[model samples]
Target: MKQMYIPVNTSLSFLLISLFATIMPAQAQSAASAKASAATSTSTSTPTSTAKPSLTVTATQVGSGQMATKLVANGSVAAWQEATIGSQSSGLRITELMVNVGDVVKRGQVLASFDSEAVRADLAQAKAALAEAEATALDSIANADRARGLQASGAISKQQIGQYLTAEQTAKARVAAAKASLDVQQLRLKYTQVVAPDAGVISARMATVGAVLGNGAELFRMIRQGRLEWRAEVTSADLSKLTAGMTATVMAPNGEQTQGKVRMVAPTVDVTNRAGLVYVDLILPKDKTAAAFKPGMFARGEFLLGSSQAITIPQQAVVVRDGFSYVFKLNPDQRVTQVKIQTGRRMQVNGSEQIEVLSGINAGTQIAASGVGFLNDGDLVKLVAPSAAVGAAPAAPAAKK
Candidate 1:
């Protein structure tokens, strides 16, 4: 009205502004509605979830209360009585080799023999010398008798008779010396033959047919009476635990087993090793099936230190993971949960099969018997019939009384 007439461009500008205002409100309203719809949809949408992992498992039921026994040991088998058979005399050549290593021999069995030509010659010479001395002694005795008769009859001087008697006495002494020499030679000749002093299995043979053995040269090694002893070296602390007459089991290097009895506990400890020796005597089996045990065979021995009751599990049930032992336990939800366990000595079940367990398990608890390699913690599993999952869970404490 002040301008009386608006410019054409100004009117156009005002129309455009009014059109923009209307369009902007509609667009704003549309955007607000879209936002409201999006909010409602988001609120009503279903949520996503992660699925539980399924695992293969076996179940073990809780073991019942049973007496637990401990059998722990580390030892070696040794001969109770070992003899190194050596030659008593020197410069004897072995002429015959009768027994070799591992030959079972009886007491007084001839093992070997040396060439006895020189010994026999010496013995013959001693015998001949003894005969000559005896003849001379007899002649002297006759002469002495004649001299004594002459002296008594006053046909010779007393001094001359005394001289004859002295000669006779010297001849008698020579005869005795020769006879003693013959006996000594015979005894020395007997030493040429080597014989088993006791019934035992031959452990070693150092003498050959042509080898010359010296005095104290070891020709054979034997254990007396076939009594194989396990010489187990134990620490001083273990020595006190081991007593004579205790029973033990021995394992040969070839996996043969035998029973033995504790015979001796050494009072003195070896200064170099700081260990004492325990002697266990093993009886050789008289039957053919048990003849595998041999002397000088490397072996291990076990002596029971003591006995205690504790939880145990089969050796097959324990799983070693990352250098640690674990056993998967089946929970009530039928899931395998890993539980750490400490293992102990393997013992025979009812004196039959061996089972080992130390801790982290109890009797009559549900545990995974096998398939532990495919399982992890919190894995879902289906428990088979006869759940092996021992100690599935502890009972609730009477609902807090």
Candidate 2:
């Protein structure tokens, strides 16, 4: 630093200038140091955070209730008892077809007829032969009596009388044989017409007028006693729960419901499918106003397997994937956790279109109803209870007997 002298009058101004220069540089250096410290603090103390997907959710409560396992297996309706009307003898031409398909017939009612002209002729011949044999037997008896009288009078030898007696006995035996032949011929003539064995509707007609039939040729298909059956095949797992006399309802292909009781359970299971056939004898409505129920129609059914207490959730709460069902449950930490569930029967709730769960959910579990349709296994969702959906169909109340 150089020692410089200045005039006394300008000393204050020069001193002021010097002080400004010193203060300005010190202030600039202090500001730069403050900025460097701030930068270092920001780089070292920053926090890490994850962004979560936002979603709306609803909650529900699960409780104990009846669990019904409904099985929807396809099957057909068949006549509980049926007969294939057929003839017994061969070489007969049908002369009349009295009844037709859908006709209700009674037992022993004539269904069809065959030409009996030949049988009638044979029967007449047998009657004539029987009459001739009877006449011959009468003549032989007279000869035998004469032979006995001659033996008593000693006019003919004993050997000659014995020969006449033998001849009479042989003619008597021939008469008996002829009578039996005539009886058989009459019986055959009666077989020319076919009759119903029981009361039922005719399902089919195979024979017609001028058609020749062989032995045991089927003519008509009759449902014996107007009875029908619903044959439903169920899986092996469910077969054990079914029993005789259990109530069952069948929905036919034409949307007709038939009420019946379980009749028989097949002992042998189908090897391929491991299922058994369940026969349900239908109780047809006797009111003529009811529609006519026929056999061989495919049907669906529900069998009441008895009721038990179980946990159930709403069907809307369940999420199905790859043939399995799952539901999202809220943990204690307000996070979602996936849980696998086993569902039982599906039932209508209070006449509303919403479905009620049969089983697998617990009581008081928070469930996401609407928004979980797009969520993944471990997604974080913001819970928001949704208002009941609009225009929802009312559920059906419990069925009353």
Writing each residue's lDDT as its tens digit, candidate 2 over 1-401 gives: 23454565479898999999999999999999999999989866775334344454666666556665565666778888778999864798888899998899999999888889898999999999989999988998898899888787899998889888998998899899998999888877878878898898898998889999898999999888888888998999988888899988787666777688999988878999988899999887876312546676677888977666566677677788889888888765555777777776666666532344444556666766655556566656655535553344323322324
* Model 1, span 1-401: residue lDDT tens: 65756687698999999999999999999999999999999877845323333544456564533443423355555566788888976898888989988788999899989989999999999999999999999999999999977886888888889989999999999999998999999988989888898898788888888998788899999877767677787887667888888888877766777787888888899999788888888866887414666545566677866666556666556779888888888776676778888776666676544355567777777787656666678766655443544444412212212
Residue 4 of model 1 has an lDDT of: 50
Worst 10 residues of 1 by lDDT: 392-401
Q: What's the lDDT of the predicted structure labeled candidate 1?
A: 0.76
**Which ranges of candidate 2 are over 4 A from the true structure?**
1-72, 145-158, 287-293, 311-343, 347-401
Q: What value of lDDT does candidate 2 attain over all alpha carbons?
A: 0.77
lDDT of each: 0.76, 0.77
Which numbered prediction scores highest in lDDT against the true structure? 2
Model 1: what TM-score? Answer: 0.64
Q: Which runs in model 1 stand beyond 4 Å of their true positions?
A: 1-82, 88-94, 143-156, 210-218, 270-274, 286-298, 313-342, 350-401
Q: For model 2, where is the 10-residue window of minimal lDDT?
A: 392-401
